[model samples]
Target: MRFIAAFAVFLFHLTMLSIHTPHGIDVLHQFKDEGVREAYNSVFHIAGFTGVSFFFALSGFVLTWSARSTDTLTGFWRRRFFKIYPLHIVTYAAGLLLLTGSAFRASDDLPGVFLLQSWIPDARVIFAANSPSWSISCEALFYVLFPLLLPLIERIPASRLWWWSAAMVAGIFAVATIGHLYVSMEYQFWFTYTLPPLRLMEFVLGIFAARLVILGRWPDIRLAPATVLLVLAYALALQLPQVYAQTAVTIVPVVLLVGAGATADIEGRSRLLRSRTMVWLGEISFAFYMVHLVVLLSARKWLGAEDSYSTPKALLVIAGCLAVTMVLAWLLHIGVERPAMRHWSVRRQDRDRGRTTASV
Candidate 1:
């Protein structure tokens, strides 16, 4: 799931690299006579936006999996905050510094450092060297509300909660679809697209899936057959008219993917995500995601390239970015993320021991 989400973001950047921006910053124009534009555009369209959908589904799955085991809201928030905010702040701060000299005034850099730059479009979109950080801002909003919303479903018995969860799913789809149509992306982009509150359904759906699993509702599903069904559903969703509503089309395959993860045995599905390579990628996915853009930006700067808009150049840029991202991610996982997790784990164990001693 993590690899899938990270790959999607990778594809998003790849797609963005192919298009011409208003500022004439397009790299492809440099090589336009090469005749690869059509192919590049087609591939970008297929792979790019789908990354966001994958991230939404994965976020739901991970959050629900954790929620199922959370003993209290405090622990849940503690775990989530420590896990996400540290890396997020690091990435955003890097962007603030990079943008300070050119894109933004030195005075605005301080405010941007704290993520208050989102309200200022000129600061966020134009100034921030890492424009992709916008998604992280939205994700932070999701992280804040998730601890509160997830445990609510667990509070009620399955008999009553199932209906409520289903209704909530329906309500979320309605709002997303209605909002997509009625609200302009210009005004509502942050609210409808980026904000976690509006996007809570994806995570909630995963929670309901976990609830179903706990209640023994999920079939001990076979791997090959389930994978086949998932592929078919994904194809159907893609073939549907774009006018058919975004969330409606997206939620179908996303639901299936989450369902497969919930029901399918990890060992039995050895060929899929459970494989050693995919598992390793998933493990380093967060670091890969946070640092990949940084690598691309740095590489372009180093190579004296402005942007990667041409097909060959974009491919080259992605190849270089992936190599650097993987190496950096592996290093960070070993040095930073792993140690942080271990330290947190040890502290948690000590606290539990202290509480046990007090009770005795």
Candidate 2:
């Protein structure tokens, strides 16, 4: 799920890089046929918005499902730090070195460096470094609140969990609808999509879902229907005036899909996510997410300087970038991400006592 979500965002960015920058690798525009270009654009355009919603909800669900009573708040925070920050540092430095100065400002540098960029309303800051990492900023805030949030969430009675879940979904919808009706696009995107507090609604929804699954209250929402719901939601979001509705509309189905996947796993019903290939990809997906844009951007600087390459060459460049990104992501996972977690994520004393607990 992580890798799939990350890849969706990747495709979305690969296309957007061209639209967003002058010298970007223009694969989408390279296609001469208007129908083909529009088809490609539509799919990739929504991919990031929906992918990010899936990730935010998945974060809450996974953390809640895997959270441990024995874990201290500091311990949990430490593990999450090592899980993300080292890779972030590497990418941040790379961004500084690789991205054009015009693309980012000194004022925006601190937020990117500290993984706090998503708080500010400015898109440049949020997208400064590894552009995909804005979501990580949200995850950072989510991590801080999780230890505090989980206990309160657990206090909700099992029977009303569904109701609370519905409320959360409704709140998401209300915010998006209101933003669509009243706010400017700038504020609308910030308020409905990028704001840490607003995005927390989705995170909390996933927490509710985790509780339902834990209590054996999760509905038997089959995958097919859940997927269709997601597609319908995305289509509807596109029709709406405020584009930020994309995340809000599809969030329910995303959580449902996550719930179904979790239920299936508990029932020993699905082997695909657990397969070695997917498991390996999932392990490195974070690195892939962190480094993919940097790789694609660099490719643009060095190899894709043309306004738009021929379709064949553009495809070749994309494949090449993917290959390099996979290698770099693998290297990051092994070299920085894994070693940091192994050595620094958990306290040695806790590990020695066999008290290290499962974490997201």
Candidate 3:
């Protein structure tokens, strides 16, 4: 499931990279003034966003699965923070340094580099970079809030929890839509795009999925055959008029994958997840996501490649970027995440001993 989600995201980015302004933007611009054309772009615009929603649902399920037992919330947060933050901080600082060196001179789309806004062409013409990491910022906020919110959310009766979860999910999207409309009126694109509250539903949907598993309800989860049918159902749902309606389509496949992972024997599934190749790519997904944009930007400028949207060239760039990002992420995972986790473990053990001694 992790592998599939990772690959889906990679494909999302790959598709996005091919959607360059030089080639596709003209097509987009011709339709900009036309309501039908604009609506079509809006539908396509939501594709990558749908991938992110799937990721959120997956994260919620995975994290809740980890904490299903009456576990110490502090320890849970500590492990999660250590596991995710060190890599993020290191990469973020490095990204900032690269942008500093370039002084936003090479790329007109600077807001993305700093993650101040989405890379919607209009939002791109701004005073920073880190476009790719905006989602990271949203993710970071979710991680922080999850630990605090979970206990309360989980305390709701198992039967009633789904209703609560549904409300929370719906509420988030409702507010985000209203917020987006408000921002549009005021031209607050930065606030509109980066607002953490607007994006919280994706993560909360994930939590709801996890809760379903915890209660053994497994709502919407099914076998591959059933999954196929649901996918058709979800695709039909995409024709609905909501922003990010395609999320309806993605949820079923993700649920099937998660269900598969949960039910599979750990010893057997571990082999699949921990295989030399799958583990390698999973380890590097973080770095691959972060660094691929840099590679694309650098290559476009240095190679003077006019065919930025060419599939062949994009595939080649993906291959090269994946190779390098894998090595780098593995190194960071070992040197940074693994070691920090151990250090936290040692500190926890020490604290436990201290409490025991004081009680004596």
Q: What is the lDDT of candidate 2?
A: 0.81
Point out where model 3 deviates above 4 Å: 15-47, 68-74, 100-129, 172-194, 223-242, 245-257, 264-276, 305-314, 344-360
Alpha-carbon deviation at 92 in model 3, angstroms: 1.8
Question: What tens digits encode model 1's per-residue C-alpha lDDT throughout 1-360?
Answer: 667767766654544442222112233333343456555544444443445555665676667765545256566656665665566567666654543335554554544355444454342342254555555555666677777776677786777655765676576567766666886655444544445456667667666767667676655655466557655654564665332233445564565566676566444554666778888998888878877666655555556555335556566666877898899888877777776665663457767887899999
As for lDDT, the candidate ahead, 2 or 3, is 2
What's the best-to-worst order under TM-score?
2, 1, 3
Better of 1 and 3 by TM-score: 1
Q: Identify the candidate with maximal lDDT.
A: 2
Q: Candidate 2 lDDT, tens digit per residue, 1-360?
A: 889998988888765645453223454565545676677776677788888888889989999989999989998999999998999989878877787456656786778788888889877677775677788889899999999999998999999998998899888888887887887866767777778888899899989999999998988887678778887887887775545546766788899999988887777766888899998999999999999888888877675445566567667878998999999999999999999999888788877666435441
Give the local distance difference test score of model 1.
0.59
The collision pairs in model 1 are 28-309, 28-310
Q: Quote each prediction's TM-score.
A: 0.77, 0.92, 0.69
TM-score of 1: 0.77
- Which pairs in model 2 have colliding backbones? none
Which stretches of model 1 miss by more than 4 angstroms?
A: 17-35, 46-48, 67-70, 98-100, 105-129, 155-169, 219-246, 304-314, 344-360
lDDT by candidate, in order shown: 0.59, 0.81, 0.55
By TM-score, the best candidate is 2
Better of 2 and 3 by TM-score: 2
